[model samples]
Target: MKELIVLTFAVPLLMAFLLPTISRVSFTLSKLIAPLVLLALAIMVVCIWNFHTETFVLHIGNFIGPQGIVFYVDRLALLFAFAIFAMTLLMWPWYFEKDESSDTRTRKLSLTLLLVAASAGMSLSGDIFNLYVFYELLAVASYGLIAAGNKKPAGNSYAAAFRYLMISALGSVFALLGIALIYFQTGTLNLAHLSEMKELLNNPAGLIAFVFILLGFGVKAELFPVNSWVPEAYMASSKRVAGLLAGLVSKLAVLVIIKALVLIYPQDEARQLLLFLGIAGVIVGEFSAMKAQDMTRMLSWSSIAQLGLVFIAFSIPGKAGMLAGLAVALHHLISKPAMFLIAERWGGSLQNLKGRAQSSPIMAALLILFALSMVGIPPLPGFWVKFLLLSGLSAQQAWLAIAVVLIMTVVETNYLYRVISSLYSRDEQQSVTSRHRTADTFSALILAGVLIFVSVQVQTVGQALDEIAQDAVDVKSYIDLSLGGGS
Candidate 1:
């Protein structure tokens, strides 16, 4: 299991570097190979799921002591890995069958592989500095992916990517500085060791270190005010890239924040800061999404809002809230990417989708199901997640927060209904193009399947997520797992 844990990440990374060499052999061959890599990842995730392991870690290359830079695999990490693999699997058809430009195809394959490698690395990384390495890899791959299509639009993509780069760089510097501070104080970069030294982090320097790390990671997680780059970036990128950014990359960053919160500052003033920022992000992201004109931009804003909910879940400081957070994270992980993919096929403008459902009921139904899931409709996995989160808030008697969430639910429903109505409305006579049939049908079927799967297994998956969430909040467990039983 440990060997597989290392290979799961290693294979994709090794493939990322080997891709250039593979491409030189033949573009067609490279295209074929890309999906094969994702397939391997998917199989590995299934194996892990069946095995149902608790937590495992592997030290790669052993550059330092016995506990050198490590890749940790736990249920939470595995959950994210599963999401990454699934997204990659769904995205494979776009490259395999779509009529994308040659440049777009090449860039897509390369960036996709890079994104996978980065995400796998982020999920598995057990050290803060190693997390930084993967985060930078994700950012750079995103820049290239965003700029890969439509030369004219590439300018906007480049601008957005550059903005994202600058902000991400600032965050990275803060995080690195915090790591340095931690090292200075505790003399260890291992997350497990840092967690054991929580008493040592009670001073002013430690507080400053926590704040810096929070702000830095908050930028990537799209927390509140630091998330201004998301909408523009999504609008500028191709649909596939936008889906990857909104659905996978942003979530990966948030997961890292959760890891840091659990390990370094599980119960302190730092947790309070996370809660406040999370509530702020939810409110701002949802309201802003309600006002968005472009579908891609709207979905991007919605991702920020959903991430806020995840943060809030983590803030509640209990098994229930953690479970809820995991559920919401997983639900959004599946649904948002599906929505972005659909928006891409339908065109960016909300107005363009008018009467689409009349022409293609299957696609229309799929969109409605996913939209409803986003809105937290009953019987959906999202509903269970929201239910758990709201329950947690209610237990704390946070009425104002609950009110805000309820209001956002209404706003979310309204905007999503507007899209659904536009698609199914009978007044318009917009012709459905044949070009979109393959992409739209494939995406719709896959999304519909996922929605159904979640609907049927909500209780089981919710239980699994709850256990994972509990594991996440157990600081001692995380530490022990990361350090191979804490020496």
Candidate 2:
């Protein structure tokens, strides 16, 4: 199990480097290897489904403590690894099948594989510096992949990529500076060590450090105020890039924030900050999405809104917060990517989707199901998580936040309803060229199946997420596990 844990991420990171060499012998082999490796990873993840609820840390070599880099896996980390690897596999057809631009197809494959590795690494990191390293790696690959494996990019694509790069670069600077400040105080880069230094970190300087780090991650997390880049980037990038960004990358970045909230600073101010920002993000994001002219742009805003919910969910300051956060995060991962892919193949703009449902009724139905789920319709996968959030807030007497959520639910429905109307709208100028492919539709159906799976096993998943959430709030346990039982 431990060896598989090590290989889960390391294989992809190392294989990405080997892909260029592999292409020399057979690009065909190299391309196939990506999915095969991912499939193996997916299998490994399922095999280890019953990973010990207690946190497990794997130190590299003889290194230990502040001097050593350690990779840690908890249930949350496993869940993250599982979601990312599986979704990338489900969406494999969309990414690899159509792009025949490279004879070897090594560059995009390498970038995609590395992106997966980086996401996994970040999730499993126990060292602050190591987390930052993985983050930078994720950022770089994301920028490259935004080009969609093309040397000659499409309109505004380079600009979108550049915007993402610029924002992330700035975020990196803030993160490094915060890291420097922490190192100056604690003289250690390990999360466990730093987590135990909450006394020192509770002061104004510590609060500043938290702000810097959060803002740095905020760029990638698509948090409000720092989320201006979402529409442009998702709109300009390919369907795969948009889906990846909206689905997995942003979630991992938010995971960093959640871990920070748990292990470093779950104080009143921090929780309030999270809640305020979260509510603000939801309101702002939904309004923006409501105003969007293009489906990609609208979905981009929705991702921001959904991430805001994740933030609010985890901000509940205890076990409930963590559980709600997990449910929301998982639901978004399963649902949003399919929508982005559908939009890519079916319609870019709402108007373009007129009579689209008539053309591919199955896909249209899938789209409607996903949209309804996202809007928090009853008995759907999305509603349960939001219900968890509302329950948590009600217990806390956070009436304002509750109001915001309820109001936004209606607003979400209205915009999604608009898209549905567009789909059903009559098109006099319909062209036969606009058609849906089975391969593309099949991947989305797999995602839909996952949603049903989530719905069916909600009770089981809910309990598991609740346990993980409890684990998050149990900061003492994380500290002990990370620092080898406090020496």
Candidate 3:
């Protein structure tokens, strides 16, 4: 059963390389292959999670130790794996415009598969070296997807992708340097081994290295200062692609930082840096979003703010931090993508959205639901997400954080209200023209259903999250399972 986990990483990678060639022979088969493979992987993850609730490890080529490739399988890893497949499948470019060529579609599908493979590898890899490798692979795949996203002849997609590449490349350099520092100090890239030598890393150089990796990964996580790529990239990409990046990819990046924090740098200095950055991100993102002129930019800035909250939640040391962060992360995962889907047709200036709700009441209603939840309305999961974060902050005596969060909530509520009002309002002369696509609407509805379901089953979901949090912060178990062969 444990061995099967390798298939999650291996199969997608193998298929990604072979898919473009396969599409040449039979495009229909190519389309079917990706989804079918993802479905199988998702089911396999569920079966594994249901049957074996214990942590495990996989050593590539049966090799062991720091020099060998290792994959640690814990509940936290599996949750990310499941999310990767599920979200990719959801955001798969299933619909095509009249001008979209089969070759274009094939390329997009192939890149998406590569992204999945790389993300799966990142989630499971037990070593920093492999994590860096997979991170770069994911970056390459994203550049392709984003570049190909816009179908318009004069669209700025290529420019956006180029900007993203520059930032990402710079981030990779810092991350590589940080990894070099770690090896220079401790002589091991394996997380398990590094965790055992945390004392050696309890110095300024170590904290600097941590900062490097955080910034490197933070580029994708929409971490402030390194996150200028967020708005342009999202604007240039298709709504689904934008949704995938904001809702899923960012969280995966955060997972990497969380692993490093839990294992190598459990000191107050590192945590404080994270806290300060998180606070800055929340303030900047929320305020910037309020000033955004269009829906896509607003959502982009909003994603940054939401991730800021996740970072803050995780900054609190312990299972409480993990749980609160998980709550916020999972909530954003559900709502943000759905909102982007709704914005597919309603993407331009907010002024143009007047009376949009009159034409598509269902879409309008879905937006209202998502907006209310984002603003932390009662009974919705977003409220509970904030409640968890606030509670954790109060426990930590983080009064400043509490104030920022509360103020940001009010800011978030006000902007979302503006959106909701515009969505429902009717102008005397200027009627909005574009209509929501059926496919996008359906996708949004599916996500809305998930949000509603989670809200209704909040108790059960919270318990499950608590258990996952418990597993996530178990540093010793992570080491034992990875280094001791998960015995």
Q: Put down candidate 3 lDDT per residue, 183-243, tens digits, no spaces.
A: 9999999998999999999999998999999999999999877999999999999999999
Model 1 RMSD in Å is 2.5
For candidate 1, the clash count comes to 0
lDDT of 1 by residue, 1-487 (tens): 6467666667877877777777777878877887887887788888987785657666677543325886777787887888788787776535433566554566667777878888888988888888888888887887777666444543777787788788878887888888789789988878877888877888889888888877777776788868888887777777777777777787888888777777777665776787788889888988888898877788888889998888887777667667767777777777887887777667657787777776666667778888877887788767877888899989878787788889888988888888888777765455655344576568658877977887898778667766777777788766665666331
lDDT tens digits, residue span 219-238, model 2: 88988778888888887766
Candidate 2: count of backbone clashes, pairs at least 3 residues apart or interchain: 0
Candidate 2 residue 232 C-alpha distance from true site, Å? 1.1
Q: Which residue segments of model 3 deviate by more than 4 Å?
A: 151-155, 430-432, 485-487
Q: Weakest 10 consecutive residues, lDDT, candidate 1?
A: 93-102
* Residue-level error in angstroms, candidate 3, position 89: 1.3
lDDT of 1: 0.77
Task: Give residue 235's error in model 2 in angstroms.
Answer: 1.2
What is model 3's C-alpha RMSD? Answer: 1.2
How many residue pairs clash in each candidate at the backbone level? 0, 0, 0
